[model samples]
Target: MPQSPTAHDPNDIQEFNLDAVAGILQDEKLDYRIDEHDGEKVIRTGFINAAISFILLDGSLTMEAMWRGAPSTDAAAQVLAATNEWNLTQFAPTIRFFELNEGTLAINALRHVVVSAGMSHNQVGSYVMSSIESAVQCFEWLEQQFPDLVTWKDEHHDH
Candidate 1:
């Protein structure tokens, strides 16, 4: 049987690792910073934080999507559109932060919302993947526009 949405508490969402994500942001040459609050750590770069805020706001706008119970295609499209908008907004803040700091760590503390947003896409089938693709495209565009601002290296896991 399908579990009802009411059974889930959005606030009881899981936490994501800032370190892993931070490494990715760093590889992309996005200035990221970390901070702690109430035993939780946040990993954000100025650009990432801004982008996340925008995406969260936009995704909230589509909250009705959950209630609509529409076709998967329609749902996917809506998710993609909102995700793209969020990615764009996120990009601006990150870029501005990069310009201000010149590729220094600028991310704020990690928040439950960021984890929730990622979970929402991950559990919702292609919605999250589509959103991720959108974000990747934006990142690529940013890289192309500012080649010096982005960099990457082989994964060197220090045990």
Candidate 2:
């Protein structure tokens, strides 16, 4: 006599491991944490960029940038909207943000945006390579012309 597909003996020891499979799935979704520090709150650095701690002070809102090559302006705008909404819904009230393309003009705009946002020069990248270095050099010149604001986190050595 052979056992039926839906039939199982109640006393049989089931030998499949379920927990190990779930653990592997969770690990794959985890983001890389680069740095963290505590002050009035906690600041963290992750795979893409740095994150400032959320504070209750007036004009104290958290923001971040995701800089990489994108297909088109429409795609970039879509990503920005999706990211902004996700951040607002999952965490803080609002976040100031933008997406920079891999082109020369977009790179220049990003430099200006970062300086205006009061982020450190080290945090920004030109993303120029090969023959594009000359164009990137021009953008750097433009960035030098614009003065950067001294942000609070750097002043207190919290970064």
Candidate 3:
């Protein structure tokens, strides 16, 4: 059996559904796909030029964006510094960066809501949409500082 997006009061705390979250994305007319990954439903989508994902892990929703290209080794420090600066000033879905290696960096926007009586539909949608915007903003900032990292293949989608 499958579930559908269930409506709830904004104040309701116990009932939350990813399907409903997916429905909100649909209502917004965004292209998205939801599939099971490692026993959790992973939502695959994008906002503007950034790829976005939503995952249910350890009872919280994790939203993140995949950076289009990895920066060179020389730019790792600058990337981390910028990420630290952004984390300090940003609110609601603070953007972060993962330094996978000297030559690889990834950007992420994250929000966590505990399971149980959970966030309302509006809250979920807000988190998802806001994270998308935040990730794009972070990407832009990175691009300004590290032009060499903008190796994204699609010019139309490369911001």
**Between the candidate structures 2 and 3, which one is better when assessed by TM-score?**
3
**Model 1 spans > 4 angstroms off:** 1-123, 154-159
**What would the per-residue lDDT of candidate 3 be over residues 1-159, giving only the tens digit for each residue?**
899988666655546667866877897898999888888888889744467888877667787677665766566688778778877877745666676776666766666666555777777777777767777777777677767767655556545
Q: Relative to the unseen true structure, what is the C-alpha lDDT of residue 16 in candidate 3, on a scale of 0 to 100? A: 65
Q: Whole-model lDDT, candidate 2? A: 0.28
Compared with the true structure, model 2 gives a TM-score of 0.22
Q: For model 2, what is the error of residue 113's alpha carbon versus the real structure, in angstroms, after optimal superposition? A: 21
**lDDT of candidate 3?**
0.72
**Weakest ten-residue segment in model 1 by summed lDDT:** 61-70
Stretches of model 2 off by over 4 angstroms after superposition: 1-45, 48-71, 93-159
Superposed by TM-score, candidate 2 places the C-alpha of residue 97 at a distance from the truth, in angstroms, of 4.2
Each candidate structure's count of clashing pairs: 10, 0, 4
* Alpha carbon deviation, residue 21, candidate 3 (Å): 1.5
Best candidate, TM-score-wise? 3
TM-score of each: 0.28, 0.22, 0.77
Show model 3 residue runs off by greater than 4 Å. Answer: 1-14, 99-102, 152-159
Q: Score residue 104 of candidate 2 by CA lDDT.
A: 18
All candidates in order of lDDT, best leading: 3, 1, 2
In candidate 2, the residue pairs with backbone N, CA or C atoms under 3 Å apart (3 or more residues apart, or in different chains) clash, namely: none
